[model samples]
Target: MPGAGTSINALPKISLHDHLDGGLRPQTIIELAEPIGFALPTTDAAALGTWFADQADSGSLVEYLKTFDVTTGVMQTREGLVRVAREFVEDLAADGVIYGEIRWAPEQHLTRGLTLDQTVEAVQEGLEAGIALVAQAGSRIRVGQLITAMRHADRGLEIAELAVRHRGNGVVGFDIAGAELGFPAHNHRDAFDFLAKAFMPVTVHAGEADGLESIRGALFDGRALRLGHGVRLAEDIEIGREDEENTYVTLGPVAQWVRDREIALELSPSSNLQTGAIAAWGDDLLDHPFDLLYQLGFRVTVNTDNRLMSNTSLTKELALLSDAFGYDEDDLEVFQLNAVQASFLPLDEREDLADAIVAGFATV
Candidate 1:
């Protein structure tokens, strides 16, 4: 059995919810911005990294989102997107991520002059370069793009089409992100409808800044195969202590359906805490309902929503969860397997990924 004595970084992992723009290296940001005449809060890479973390530490999701303006500011060109995407995959490989799905909105990266297709192609080239670099080092890592649309925008159908157009390329799935409160998934019904007809896989940013109603829209309206930081689904759970040793957790329809249907929850521990996504429960990691959901047999998979903003990696996220819940290596492996099962990859590829994960963990 895998145990806590093994190093978490050495374990093979799958990242289901990492954001591409949000994972840019500070030094890379500085280099990329230099050619574009972009103004940053600071040019010093280390200081700039700290600034991102500090800005995102605010307890409001809206306030936390303001930091993305800076990251996306530098990624408005083909070169910038390529460099950022390449380094993003290298970072994932270094962190022991065997498979990862990088999510970003192409609409957000078109400010400088790049068309949506150009942005996707640029990022795909970078991802391929990064994968090749890893392979050259005698290591293997696979990554796919989850083309995202900003929920507050009306470009969902266009973005969904872009994702489908590149389905045979590096693109694997679609996602809707950005402010989840007022803009329900129904706002992008046409896009979701198109994706449903095209048979494209989807994941939605629900139950993060909103409650059950928003999640319901993501399911019934957006048809999300997975939930992006769906921590607030816990709001639907009612807990009562029967005694010192016994407790009762009553699940609402939303929570019950999510659990019963085996829909994956792309939980980001640090990002969730920083954005107040788990505020209904408490302020610290201990207060997070991740352990509760996991114990209850929900398809809970761990992730780093924004590595730069949260200053975390897949390894660190796993370590933090382990520390908070006293989870052992076996528990971590279970989480990795959950991600593999939920990935948009085809059946044989997912089976291969699962086999690789089990083999990697066996050595630990």
Candidate 2:
């Protein structure tokens, strides 16, 4: 097991739904805060990081989100945004992520004087800088931003236009995050409509905090290219033993459509458990519906929805999944392939990513 991560690291990986604000390094936060005169839960990076993970897993959703109050607090400036984004890529590179899509609601970053364009440009600068640094270190990583609109807020249309305006410049897609239960996808119809007309790719954070109706809304209304934490879609699936030799699986309409259409499920195991997203089934990693959905041929991709909050890297998430589900190199390779296929990049780029993944995996 000591070398398990080493092998997995040698394998190629793609991240589909990682959050930008949610992946900051605590030490970076502490350092960035000192100059800005910001207060923190704890000044020690180790303690503050654990505080975040513990608070997130504290079993109360209200308490969990309070952790973000700290992360987002420090990310309100151009320097903070750039530092976080720069470190975000470096971390992904260290974890062997070849390509990743980092999603965050830009509206959340406007608490300072930064315009939406400023924030996006700052993050892009950081990403490019990080990529350059990694390349200098003899590694490679490709990262794109998924501009998100907060679902509970009324800024979806504004965010959509912002996303469209930056399409070719690091912004690859649009998404909606936050409170999927009440803020149904239909509420963002105008935004989604505009995205559709612009032929922009979109992913929705549904089937995590809510159930099938939310998933339905995401598909019918948001036209999601991928499901952000769509693990709960397993609710529509019934798995029964068929004579101990085979298992019979029945998918209700929603799950069936998702599986048949190969809509990617951006399932983050640790984040899902921390947020109670998998509570309907059980409270353990083994109880996660990730394996079930993958076995049933849904486009199941692994992610770390909130790396800082969940105290995880995508490698750690995949390691945990392997421990829970006995996943091997082949299984891990399949997830990478799924992500490459579902990426917002053009077909040629996607194919190139697939080749890179294949070559990386072959190294082991």
Best candidate (score: TM-score)? 1
How far off is residue 174 in model 2, in Å?
A: 0.6
Report RMSD for candidate 1.
Answer: 1.2
Q: Per-model C-alpha lDDT, please?
A: 0.94, 0.89
Compared with the true structure, what per-residue lDDT tens digits does model 2 show for residues 1-117?
A: 324445666567899989888888989989988888889888999998888888899654446667777888888999989989999999999988999999988898878799999
Candidate 2 clashes between residue pairs 3 or more apart in a chain or in different chains: none
For candidate 1, what is the lDDT? 0.94
Please provide, for model 1 over 204-237, each residue's C-alpha lDDT reduced to its tens digit, 9 standing for 90 to 100.
Answer: 9999999899999999999999999889999999
- Indicate the TM-score of model 1: 0.98
How far off is residue 242 in model 1, in Å? 3.1
Write down the lDDT that model 2 would get: 0.89
